[model samples]
Structures are given as structure tokens and as C-alpha cells.
Target: MARTGSGTGSGTLLCRRNIKLDSFLKRNTERAVYERIRTYEPCVVISETINKVYMHVVLSDERVYLTEYPPRALTIAFSFRRVRDIELVNDLPDFLSGKDRELCQHIRITYLTEKPAAKGRDWLRRDKREGLPPAAPPSRRNSHSPTIIRTSEGYPAHRVQGEGGTEEVHMLPPTRSASWPNPESLGLLKVPHPPARPPSKPPSLYSLSSSPSISPSPSDQRLNIGESAQVPRRMGSVLSRLLRRDGGSSREERQAELHLYAVSRTSRLYLHLQSSWNSYIIRSTLSLDPLYRRRCSVLSDSTPDKRLPSISLERTAHLFGQLSAELLQEEISVESLYLLLQELRTAAHRNVALRRLFWRSSEVCVFLVQTLEESLHGCQSLSGGYTADQLLLSTLIVQTLAVMFRETEVEAARHILLSAKKGALASRMLLALICDPELQTENQGSLADCELQALLADYLDAACSLLFEMLLLGQEASRCSPAENCVSIGWILRVIQPHPHLLDFLSYQAQHVVLVLSDLQESCLSPAQCVLLFQRCRLLLACLQYNSQLAQHLRSHFREEFRYSVKLSCAEEKLPLQYPISQPTLRLVEQILTLHRKLHTNTRALTSEKGL
Candidate 1:
């Protein structure tokens, strides 16, 4: 009978006073229900009653508890699962006293009942006593029609007293007369009447008879049963047809076609990039920068005053539309489009400012994924199934998923994979890329070698970047609780655990980064491509040294590579880049290498201590 404080430990106790009673009881009831039902927590507490004050408690999770307190405390529980219906009664009959009437705000709950008669009985039986009655001839005018039976109050009977060589026939819509049918007369047993419909709704067309408890008039009987049945059928057919028409039965197919067209459209424009330089406008006039590149690639939304550009799916579509028209008149390079897409993909992956822009305009990401999926599938099929284009697109999808996952949007990430029917398709591409031999590409000539190695490197870089993001997400969990950290770290481990080759590939990529950085000293890369390669290397080195799981595995699986990374991390100098690197890029590389050294030193010390 004693009630404690609010379940939230808020110190407030529920009061029974009239002024606060209803709200108090409602809130407490909701708390109680939520505590009871953990899996399917109640969505909302729709209605509650406390008129009798101790009569009942309704909680949001569809449980009702009746309680009595003070004198003899008792509790009874009922769930919504057994309930047939709930009705709110606001009116009181004239016979009720004022106080009783005022307390009539209680709800009426009905539970489903098991009716015995409904399951076990054959309600009607035909009497069989043969060879006794003599036949009576029918009258001339009524010979073709069946005999009609009527009782005194104009109710119809199933049969009348008539002489004939009798035969029993079961009939439809058995008549109910002034009195219920008896076993002696027709071998009929009593059955309970069906529940009546609420008076507010119009009569149902599918109900057993058109009129209720009354025989149809002569004129009404003239309308045939077929006509009545067809009325409802026709109405249903029309409604279904309208729904199908409005929803467009070919919606999915049409969407695929549109997505394909968009990809094809972009492809045509991009192919113009490889064309003769004189065919188009020069690069100086265009804003060819990847949007928010530096801000997004780094983990900082550090600048409060910076305004990140807002790009939506609709805006991207509109831009494509305008540009496509311009491509007809003058040459526009595909690099601009690629840079925007790259920026968009980056923005979707990192820092809150760009992420907010992405979430505000989600459809653009959706369309981008769809276009990529369709385009990648087409490229795979046309190129006999393992093209650079296909592998690149698959990596883009994984990159997009990583971004969504980083934002803690697991469902959004799942949807993008499933939505295009490319969930398995992307997996196949990744698997093929992994298992495909590198032996053939080496012999294909320098042009082919550079192209294939670059593509493979990009793919590996993307995979490593996703792993880094996953570890970053785990780091974010430290702000919450130890349990959250376990879950976050566990998720990262589980994801990478399946792809052991991913770890192997990252190990290879780390070594390749060392080579690429050495190559950057001699070979000139476009600024954008150069920036991307540096970022990839930084991410690879950072993830290898910092992520406990990856770092542990790397040290075991690729010991020599791990030792080299440690040496690079510990060395008190920078690997010089002869091909003048930008100040920002140089600074980022130094920061990453410094971080790697610090993390590696700490981890090595921890390992030695653990061993001791």
C-alpha cells in the first residue's frame, strides 16, 4: 500500500488529491508500465482514468492494473493482448445521482470471450421421418414459386405448414420469426446472436442480410442477391484500381531507369574530360575546388565562423540539369563534378557542420548512392565483371556507409546498401577485387600498371579510412561510459574481424604509403590527388598505431612492417618531400606522425608492463 518516490528517483511522490491526482497517477502508471515491458516499450500513454481514484491504472505499454489501497490492498493485472475493445464513456443516465454521474469518466474495457456454442455445434438439422405424409397439389397460380411463410408480426419463417411429398432443403439466410426456432418443429438449436455494430456506422454491405431483423418488402425483394453482392465487389475493385494507378505499379522500375539515365548523363559529360583540351573551356574560370576539403578531411569542426556550403540532392540535380544543357553548347570538364561528389562524400563522412548539411539534404546522398550502384553494376557487366570503375564505386559506397556509421546512423547506412538491390552486388565486387591476381596487371605495360595500381591503392586507402572512422567512433564512446566504450570498441572489432584481409591490405597499404610518399618526392601529382594520397597515408599510419585492435593484429601479422612504422614514428625527423608540398599538408603529416609516435610508445610500454 506504500508508494515510493517517482521511478526516476526525482523525490516527488504521486499524490491522490483531486487537484493533482489524475496527472500524478498517469505519470506513475506510465513509469510502472515501462519498467515492466522492456522489449516493446509503450509508444504513448493515450488515455487514463482515475475517477474512482483507486480503480485502475493504464500504462503506455498497453497494460492495465487495478489497485486498491489502505483498507485491503489488492492488485489485478490485464494486458492489451486479451482486450477486445476499449470504450470511453462520458455520459450518465438520468437515474444516476450527481456524484456517481461525475465519476463516470472511467473507461469500459471488454475482453475477448470464448463462446462454446460457436465451436461445437451444428445449429440446424433436417428431420427424417419418411413414407407417411400424402401429397397436396399446388394451386395453379403459385405452382412455379416456392411457398412463402409469414408470422403474425410480419416476420418471415423458414417454413410453413404445407402438405407435400416432403423433402428437406438447406436454404440461405434462414428466417428469424416472432419466436426462436425449436428442436421439435425444425430440429434447430438456439444460438447466440452476433454482436451488434455501433449505431454510428452505416450498415455493412457484407452483413448476412440487407435488412436487420425484418423481412424485405415486396419491392425490396425484387432486387436480386447477385446485384447486392456485385455492388460491394465493384466498389472494392474500383478502389483497388485507383490505389494501384495512383501508386504507380512500375515505380521501382521507373526509378531504376531514371537513376541509370542520370549516371549515363554524367558519364557522357565526364568522357569529354579525356577529349582534346581545345574542345572546351579552360580550368581557370571554374570553381574547381572540392568543397570544404580541408575542414572535412581533418577531425575538426574547429572553426565556428566558417560557413560550409549547403548542397542538397535537389540542388545537385539542378546543377546537373544546368550543366548538361551547357555541355551541349560548350565543353565543361568532369573534374568539377567529381570534385563536388568527392566533397559531398567527405562532408557526409566528417565534422558536424558538413554532416548537418548532409542530414538536412539526405535525398542527395540517396540519389548519389543509387546512381553509383546502377552505374557500377553496368560497368561490371559491360567490362566482363571487374573494372576499375566498379571497384571504385564499391569503395565509394563503403565510404558513404562509414560516414553514416560515424554519424551513428546505422539504419541509414543499412538502407543505402539495401535500397539499390546492390547489397550483395557490392560484396561481390569487393570479394573479386580481393581475390583477383595482381600478376597480370604488372605485365600490361606502365600505363596499365599505373592505372591498375592506382585504382587498387585507392580501394585499399578507402577501406583503411573506414576502419579509422570506426575506431574514431569507438573513441567517442569514452565520453559516455565504460560499457559504451566496450560496445563501441566491440563493434569496431567485430566489423574488421570478419575481413582479416582488410587488416592485411592495410598493412600492405602502410608500406605502400611509405613508397608513395617517397614517390611524391620525385613524381608530380595534381594538387587534389596529392592531397588525397597524403590524407590516406596519414589515416593509414594513424589507424595502425592508435587503434588497439588493428595495432595489435598488425604487430603480430606483419611484424617487419610494424617495426618499420614504429621506426618511422620514433625518428626525430620528417621524411623530406622534394616535390614542394603545401604548408598545410606538411603540417598535417607532421602532426599525424607525431601522434603515431606518442600512441605507439604508450602502447609498447603498456604491452611490456602487461607481460611483466
Candidate 2:
């Protein structure tokens, strides 16, 4: 019996050892599996806790994962692409304890999802059939305890830990270094060495010498030099201490530090304001107003033009499209953007002389038009009364289109007009405003009509001024080599000729051309050249006499104007009143005189025919 008992005991001991070995192998296998899976699905550990804690924070390229390992592991991954906002709240007082006390810090992340989970509803239901014990109700004692709050798929929710929690913290592998000291301790106790005792002064044999002397001595006088220098040093030291609590720093350095702090504070405030504005824009774009609407008006009371309001500039950008995109992206402010537009508009108005005004106005208008088009494209679902900025944009578009038409960019004007909501009406209004005053002689105009006329005239003057430059170039070219086949005069003549149905905008410009020629005859051209030019001018006059108004204007004013110019050139040359002209020029002059007489006679006959 003793032998049997001994064998059975040995077998029982073996069985116990085998059971323990199996358990140890199983635990090791579970750990190895975890490491293998993590290696395959690579992720960077941002932070971790090693006290058998349930929560883990991991960062991947596109998402941040927060995993809870309560009995079983479950993860909630938030993609950065869907993350709308991220905020770090530090030193938050424990709020649920019915007291305003700072308790801990937390990271608050707001993200968007296509299918959001229903609020206040648990994802998991308790299975009583599994025979699991019910979770204890949370109380004040366990408010911040490492207890499972909720469970999903048999895994517990993350336990909220505090800064004072007894958990071993670890940083990401890339950021970790063995050389770095642990930062878990709240305070460090620096061991101090004992101070050495000062030697006792020998019983003063000269008590009088130890006492401070009031009388001036040679040695004391020498020390005064050192003491005088030390006075300023003390004052400087005190001033430096007042400015900076540590080492001596100059006033400039102190000021620079202050300025740096101010700049940093300003930048932080700006970022916060921008984030809030972005949230507002997102809501506005969606036409969902959970909060009260923000009614920001960008109008300035000190605007120079009463007809147009100044847009407050809140951002700087190279292009309006870029500015608009920045505004949508919360990278720039509306005030800066609008202020730039206003300044450009003011400059354009000031320079209404055609060349400068044309380029400036075109630049401003094109920018405004592009911005408006983009805004319209993004405004499909939005519905609300237009803001001041929106109205300002609309007004700018209208003004720009008006300027385009007045400057004879009719095709561009038509294209832009067609893209607007009330394009036809705008086109008609612009046309009426720019129509020749000669065509509206009897009617007294309204204020808007008068304003329109002024705008049109300014634009026309700019257009006509461009023609002046062309004429000046032609005159210069002609003078350089009059014998060369000059096509400039021919081109201008062809372009300026009046047509019955088409409106003539170049009548005034043609008169201006004659004036330019007269100026050229006096200053830039020789007597022979002037006579040659005069001959060409006379021929041009005859061809243009088909128009009764041009014919009458030339006969009454311009013919005399050229004649006086030619006579002045003769006087300047100190020549006889009648000089022998070249055969070609002389023949041209004679033909012009003949044509003038014939045209006048035909005019009389035509008038009589009409009367009959």
C-alpha cells in the first residue's frame, strides 16, 4: 500500500507540473500572436500605459486609433481626413464632483462620419445567458477609477486616467531614448552637502579700525573711486532685476521678449478666431444653423465713393480666386481680401484716363468676377439674405461689366453678362447709359442716367486717348520716312469711316486726329512734308464727305484748320506764298479741290431732289 501511494503522489505531482507548463506556453503564444499581428499591420505608438491598463493610443498615416483591451481588445479609429477639429484641453477641473476644480487634461477630437452612431445609445447589449456579473454603478469614490464604464463585443470602454494616476507612461519608440531621465516623479529631492563653518575672527586688537570711518583718509579716498563706479552698477543691477527676474538683460532685450510674447499671443488668438470662423462657414455652406447666425458686415463709413462701399481687407492674396479659396479654407480673413479690392477700385476711379484706367479696371473687374463666379458655384444649397460683402461683390460685378462695354470690349462684356442672373436687364441699362447724348437731345435725364453718362464719357475718353497714341505713332512713322509706303493713315481712315446703321464712336476721334496732324505740321514735319500730309488729308476729307455731318464739320472748321497749319509751315520756311509743289502732291491737291466743288454741287442737287 505504501508503494502504491508513493507512485500515485508522484503521478499527481507530474500532472500538476504539466498543467502549469501548458498555461505558461499558452500565455507566451498569446503575446507572440499580438506582436506578429502588430508587426504586419504597422502603426506608430504615440503614447502608451504599461500598468495592465486598458487604453492604447496609436497613430497611423491616415488615422488615430484608440484601443481598449478590457478582457478583449476593441479599437475606435478616427481618420485624420474626417477629423474636423482637434483641441487639447489642459488642467481641466473635475466638473462632475459639483465643484469648480481643475482635475485633469484631455484631448478632444471632433470628427465627421458618413454614418454616425446614434447618440446616447449603447452599441452592445448585456447577455445574461453568458452568466457575467453586472457592472457596479459608478459613484464619487470610483468617478475617476480604472473601471470598465461600458462594453462592446465583450471589450470594455477606455478608462479615463488622470495626470496623478499610478500608471507607467511610455512615449513612441522613435521619440524614446534610454539616456533620457524618467519624468514620472512630481518633484526631485536634490541631496545637499553641509556648509563649512567660517573661521572666528581673532579677538579684535584694533576695535577702532573695525568701526566705519567718517573722516577722509588717503586709503579711504582711493576706495571712493571704486565705490562711485559701484553706485551706477547697483542702479543698473536693480533696473535689470526689475525687468527680468534672472540675469542682467538690457532694456532692448526685455522689450524684444515682450514683443515676442505679444506676437505669439496674437497668433494664437488669430488661430482660435479662424477655427471658429471655419466652423461657421461649414455650417453656412450646409445651410444648417444650430447656433445663432453670424451677421458680419464689412462696410466702412469712411468710403470715398458714395455709390460704392469699401470692402474691408482682412487677408492678402495674389489672385482673387486664391483669396476666395483661402477664405473657404479658413486661411485668410474676409476683411483683408475686401480691403485690397476697395483700394484697387479707388485707384481705378482716380486714373479714369483711358490707358491706365483700362488696365486697372480690367484687372479689378476680372478678379471680382472670378470671385463672384466661385462664390455662386459654392452657394447652391445656401439660403439667406445676402451679407454686406455679398452685396458689395454683386455691385462690383455690375460696375465691371459696365466699364467693359464702355471700353468697347463688347464680346467680353456680353459673355460675362450672359453668366449673371439679370444679364439682359444689365446689358440694356448699360447700353442706354452709354448711348450718345446727341441721340437723346429732348429728354431731361434722371440722376442715375446722368451718373451713367459721366461713367460712359470717362470710359470713352480713355478709349479715344488710346487712338491718340496710335495716331501719334503713325505721325512719327510717316515723318521718319514719308517716302516709305505708309499704311497707318489708310488703316485709320478705313476704320473711322461712318456707316448708316452702325453707331459712330470715332467721329470725335477723327477730329482729334486732324488736330494731331495740325500739331505735327507746326513742329515735327518740314514744309514739303507738311504739304504732302495736307494733300493726303484733303483726299481723306473728300472720301469722308459722304456723311453730311462730317462734311459740314470739315467745311466749317477742319478745312480751315489744315490750311492755317500749311500756311504756318510756309512762313517758318521763309518762302514765297505760292511755291512750286511736286507733281504727285500738286496733282493730289488739285483733285481734292475739284472733288470739294463737285461734292457741294451734288449736295445742292440732292437737297433739291428731296424737297421735290
lDDT of each: 0.33, 0.30
Best by TM-score: 1
**lDDT score, candidate 1, position 196:** 35
Give the alpha carbon lDDT tens digit for every residue of 566-612 in model 2. Answer: 33333333322223222223334445445556666776798999999
Clashes of 2: 13
Clashes of each: 1, 13
Give the C-alpha lDDT of model 1.
Answer: 0.33
Runs in model 1 lying further than 4 Å from the true structure: 1-354, 360-385, 395-443, 446-450, 482-490, 516-549, 556-558, 561-612
Expressed as tens digits, the lDDT of each residue in 95-211 for candidate 1 is 234564343232334333221111222222133332222111222211111222223434232211101101112122236322222212221122232333333433211111211
Question: Where is model 1 poorest over a 10-residue stretch in terms of lDDT?
Answer: 254-263
lDDT of 2: 0.30
